[model samples]
Target: MRPMRLLGLKTFRHGVHPPESKDETSGLPIRQFPFAPLLIVPLVQHMGAPSIPVVEEGQEVQRGQRIARPDGFMSVSMHAPASGLVRRVALAPSISGRMVPAVYLEPFPGSTQEIEDGTPCPLEATPEEIIAAIQDAGVVGLGGAAFPTHVKLKIPEGKFVDTLIINGVECEPFLTTDHRVMLEESRDIFTGIRYLLKVTGAENVIIAVEANKADAAEHLRETFPSDLNGSVEVLQVKYPQGAEKMLFSALLGREVPSRGLPLDIHALCCNVATTAQVGQLLPRGRGIQERVITVTGPAVKRKGNYRIPIGTPLRFLLEHVGVADDVNRVFLGGPMMGAAAPSLEISITKGTSGVTAFTDTAAERTHSPVYPCIRCGYCVDACPIFLDPALLGKLAATEQFSTMTDEHHLMDCFECGSCSFVCPSHIPLVQRFRAAKAAVRKSKAGAA
Candidate 1:
């Protein structure tokens, strides 16, 4: 392996490291998860405005056929996973606990794996054209955030993106989807970087990985430059190191101001999987009807990485993957910050990067009642973004939404769930902040 000509960038301050159950699935290669007979495609799968449904009930659609269209600037389109008959497009139960618009499809028996819809995306596509192609490809950040990649690629006026920071550091525990993608899909990653460089016009491209995944780092180190004009960089294996602001800081020595974006620092950060998907889909002009996900946990009997079609029912995934016996708790992503679904019956979305299941014994039961803060200041020390979660929780409890912003930097909280993780009182500190922030937004709109 060649030595890295590494330019170690400045990273952000304090963060914590919870137990990362990475070994359970990190070594496993990618495999296809058996398609669920029925799919529930969420309209708001990708970050941004909800996609407007175009397909109607009983319509026979081919694989890769567009079922939804971009409703706004920050949205991406949705596609049929397989050549299937559209059962219906109606309000369905989502992982978000509401009836969001979803497209229900019954997979056609023995549907051939075929879904290419447009001319090959040239590496030299113009900035506008590239963004359009990316949007057309249905590319969104696959790291659970699901932000539209086209929006990130399109730099606004007066904003020059000199650096394209690739997030290779999969900091979240039990989530090896990014790590496995880096290991197995090196070619796709390189191809993705080429497109990113061309679209963003970035002079420098950096792939930041943690020290733990030295193999992934080494693989990228050898393949990146050969793949494009940019470079790959290895950094300290730190939690939240993959966060845009933190990754920018770690690789570029710049800090994105609170409530600002990496764009503010003249940098554009993208998930490695997003780039890999871009490489795979853009040339074929295919929409993101499927994504790679890591399904592993103590509860799962057969744990490995699987390429699951978007909109497949989560229960089917669990059952097919040998979770038939265990799996009382299911996490959509990583355990540290991932959302817990009450049941596995909800359908997977574009953002479903990993499906983590825990057995009854493995699932930690927090029987202790929520107690008052002892002023231990543990959450204060653990916060990576440097917000006082204790105060925010208290204010939220008292319905002081206005004070949460006027005094505390409530909007700055990205709801990373760091504070909640370290809270000695078992308080749902992050949830309180989320509620408070939502309330503040509501109050502001009411005032207007």
Candidate 2:
């Protein structure tokens, strides 16, 4: 075997190495969380226009029944996770801290967890037909982006796609959803990839996984028959290696132009879990109702990977997982890019990949007094996209958001939090950039 070398690993430049913090749940098998009293399926789960509710309050719905329809091409439909009665259509708290229109369901007593909904499409379905099936199944990028899968897969006019990149690199700490999925649901993942290859007509497929999960890579290598024009590439365990641009560069050595997508480089990337869902759901003609998630952190009593139903409340998850009374913070994703949950009443949407709770001790922030930058270039050294975070943070502090974007290349930063991680002064650089970006967007919207 080749010697293990961190420097020899395939990775991009300038990223931080935070604590892995995954041992607690990495080895645990995925368990199914019991149904909550009520499910709150939100319309605004996807990135585009929210779905429109097709059912009325007090109406009955079956498992895999459509409750809402897409409002536009960019939007996606919504489905019921269980056979139940519609409790009401009302505004509910979302992780974004905003109230969104949602369909509430009171599941029928003794309803089995089986999904018996959807019409099967033939294996030889045409590309257009497959795209329709995907849209009908309500598939989205499950890697936390939640962009409509069909929108990303549909090759636009005058454009061509050559390669499909499947991301199995669950590099985020304390999250093992994708790792477990890659191991337990390997066949489904490949089935999804085959559909993806057919959808985009890509010449080849590449599945990128981190070195930490070499077993998953090896399993795929051994079990996956060699005719799919696909290969498993092991990436160096690095923070933000799962970022689309960084992973693209690390694997292909090609720089995606700033503000450009993978499709611009004749490559399209999809989360492995998302692809697996397409493969699993489309053939059965069923829609997505739940997904695998990691419910792990220091404060969680029963830490493990879970196949959780979509629309399960955060309170339900915390109560089911048995969080400590002294839990200081709960986040919706991983520590690096995940957002803090504002309320326990907020339901888990399709985009939610992990539910993490940190106790007071684990969630403590640096108490050292904030100091001015010492002209240290640590932030610069840690930035993967080569943006000067110190400069951008200063510009943001002064409310010069326009200057930060136009001259300093502020938007290029994917907010992977590397600069903040390495900053000796403990400056909240990522927070500032996010605020600056939001401000710029708001300003542009107001002008428009």
Off by over 4 Å in 1: 1-11, 227-229, 324-326
Candidate 1 yields a Cα-based lDDT of: 0.82
On residues 1-448, what C-alpha lDDT tens digit does candidate 2 reach at each position?
Answer: 1223356678887687889888788788889888889999999999999999999999988888888998888998889988899999999999888999999999998877567767876559999999888888888889998999999999988778787899999878888899899899988888899888988999888899998898889988988867788789898988888998887788777778888877888888999999889878988889999999999899999999999888999999899989898998999999988889999999989999998999988877645667788769999988989899998888888999889989988888888899888899989899999999999899999999
Candidate 2 lDDT (Cα, 0 to 1): 0.88
Off by over 4 Å in 2: 1-7, 366-369
Give the least accurate 10-residue stretch of model 2, judged by summed lDDT.
Answer: 1-10
Best of the candidates, lDDT: 2
What value does the lDDT take at residue 296 in candidate 1?
Answer: 85
| Every candidate's lDDT | 0.82, 0.88
**Per-residue CA lDDT of candidate 1, range 243-335, in tens?**
777776666667778778878889998899998999888878888878889888888888898999988888788878877465578889878
True-vs-predicted CA distance for residue 267, candidate 1, Å: 0.7
